[model samples]
Target: MIPLSPEILAALALALLAGLVAGAWPARRRLLAQAAEAARQAERAAQLQDRVAQLERDLSAQADALESWRARAQDGRLELAQLQAAHHEKLAAFEELRQAFDQSRATLRAEFQHLAGQVLEEKSQGFSRSSQDALGSLLRPFREQIESFQRRVNEIHDASVSGQARLDTEIRRVLETGLKMSDEAQSLAMALKGDKKATGNWGEVLLERSLQLAGLIAGDHYQAQASFRDEAGNRRQPDFIVRLPDGKHLIIDSKVSLVDYDRAVSAATPEAREAALVAHVRAVRQHIDDLARKDYSSLTGMKSPGFVLMYLPIEPAYIEAMRRDRELFDHGYRHNVVLVSHTTLMPVLRTVATLWMLARSNEQARALGDQAGGLYRQVEMVAARLQKLGHALGAAAAHYNGTVTAVAGQRGLYGKVGRFAELSAKAGRPLPALEPLLADFEVQRLDGIAPGADHVPETGRADAGSPPGAVPEDLHPPGEPNP
Candidate 1:
């Protein structure tokens, strides 16, 4: 080969370098793509692992729930078994009771059939000669008794008939009298309706009667036609003034007009009645307003309530007024006027009376409490004095015991006697034997004195034949004294 030129060699080297660079780029790109694929596959595997873990956790929770449900089901099965067993036992008992009842019923039926057959046989046999005679003897008294009962029943029937006739006559008379009384009452009502003063008087009378029925006396509980001056110096006379326990007065006015109410009641046509009813309602409202304007609380020397009562003598008039005006009661209340009938006022008066009674009882109780307190103090003082007396008695008993012990000592009277005797013997002149005196002056102890021991000589006093404070001859140690 000829010697290669430098340019040719350089061109060949460049071609080789270009071809190597191109091949390396393809290999690097393939490696990068492989790495990216491997990363994606790893990420997918990690997500699948998380999903598997979540599924396992869910399965675990489901298994735990299934276990719990199984436990509950087992418990339910046990309870159902117990209930079924109890039901079986009850069924067995019921069957046994049914068999027993059937047996008893069959036995009763057989016995009844036998008895019925015997009765039929006896009935078919009819009465024998002796049985018939005996039966006739037995039935004779019954027959006589039945005859006497029949006679008594006939007498009672006759008497009842007469009495019924008399009762019917009396009933007719009573009916006639009732009708007459009703007519008279209607006439009186009409008369009352025509006269305003009379109507007021009637209402006052009814109020007084109601108060009396409620255990309230006229002068003691209430006053009639009591006049008082209002705040505007207007002299108003209420039908009645009831006194309460608190010194408060309830003013009651009974001069309400009833003419429209009477007209409403007697009206023939509905329109006329409605008109009269309206008029009645208007009259009542006017009366309520008038009474409210009176200002009864301003009465001098009397603690009157803010409200006044508008008294309606008749119950029918009151009912009609209320029926005509549905809001009449509310309206009256607003105006401080209370409308009341005889029937309604009775309870109010009774309540007032009860309040008074309670107040009186309270006063009595207070007085009794004060007296009891004083009595308790006196009792305490008495108890104190008794305690002091007991102490003084105890001290006296102690001093008496000490004196008794000193006087009854061994070296006391007996020792003195013995010394005196010795001195007498030394002087050649023995004193009369004092032993006899010592014997007569023996000491005795008593446990306690009997209740009626005044006749017995006291231990501190001289006996009939002994010295002072000496025991008697009949007295013995640890024994009862001779009577």
Candidate 2:
């Protein structure tokens, strides 16, 4: 135990030594690691403090800038709000003023139109009165002369009526005397026995006088042809054959259709009148058929040959008979046969004259159109010059408009301010606020200040003098207090 073997003694010493070294090594390593950790903590603390100080400075500067910006933003917001409110207020007032102006303008236009109508009415009445009075004065002598002629005509008509009655009575008496003696001569007039030359000649005299009054040569323009050849070369004598403008022949057979008139005069009772009317209708039908058989259109190869004017030198009573029979009249018209009585002959002649005039006028108008066309072409150069003049005038107007607008702008500014001063002077005191009650000192809304405004003049003309209401003082009302 005291002295061990060499290996045992060395092992024990080495063991002791190893034990001490191991314990000391662990203690030194622990101390060294603690010191390193402490140094790392100190370096970290320094870096963190520097970072915190930088962060504080940055936050302070940021806070100051944010406050400054907020103040400026608030100020800008206030100003923008004020401008918006003012714009809205101005727009509202302008709309109100515009509506008032439109109403006033409409009222003025209506009043002016009413006054113009009254003036025109009064003027028309005066003109009518003057015309009537002048016509009365001028026609006084003519009216008296007309009355005198009418009286003479009435007296003549009465005398003729009396004489005709006496003649009728004498003729009846003579017929009665003859019927009592010669049975063949019963109720037969001497004229009906072909003993009167005056009856046939009287018709020719009437024809000559009527034609003369109507401006026609009896034989040259129209005449009664006793003998005429038909299309088949058959010799036939019509009452009258008229030569057309183209030398074509037309037949004019004179016949009186007096069915209605005879019925009207001869009927003694209502039943008899009715019976006679029926007979007259049958007779008229027969007459229309007979007239239609006379193919007047075939009388000549004229284009409008079917149209024939059937002449009837008869009284109005006979004409009225045909007129009363609508079927007969329509039948005749449809057959292209225009029945012309003595009363209607003049109108027929006038129609023919108008037709001739129309043809002549048409030819004249065509000639005039071509002649005038050439004259219009000759002035084409002058027309182009006039068009150029019109263009130049438009350009000049544009330039003048620009100048007037510029002048009006400048003048309006100065005039409005000057007028404001003058109005206060005229009132002898400072002006009150421009409120709804005030009638003077119109605002921009009433004046229509905007460009392209409906109330503004399109292009103002130059004027040496000022326009109406240019001076506000002139339009200012007298206040309650004397000025």
> Top TM-score: which candidate number?
1
| TM-score on alpha carbons, each prediction | 0.47, 0.29
Question: Which parts of model 2 have CA positions greater than 4 angstroms off?
Answer: 1-209, 231-233, 244-251, 257-267, 270-281, 300-304, 353-483
Error of 1 at 396 (Å): 1.6
Off by over 4 Å in 1: 1-187, 409-418, 421-483
> Candidate 2's error at 265, in angstroms?
2.4
The lDDT of each candidate is: 0.57, 0.44
What is residue 148's positional error in candidate 2, in angstroms?
49
lDDT of 1 by residue, 1-483 (tens): 799899999999999999999989989999999999999999999989977976796577557545643554465345435534643553344344333333433443354344334433433244367854664464354345434433533443354345334433532343234224334433556676568777777666666766775667788889997777767777877778999988889888888877887787688865787798799899899988877777665678767768888887665567567755889999999988888865456546656765765565445334333432333233233233333433444465566556555555565554556567665656565434322111111011111211122343332233455322222322222343321
Clashing pairs in 1: none
Candidate RMSDs in Å, in order, are 41.8, 57.1
444, model 1: CA deviation in Å? 30
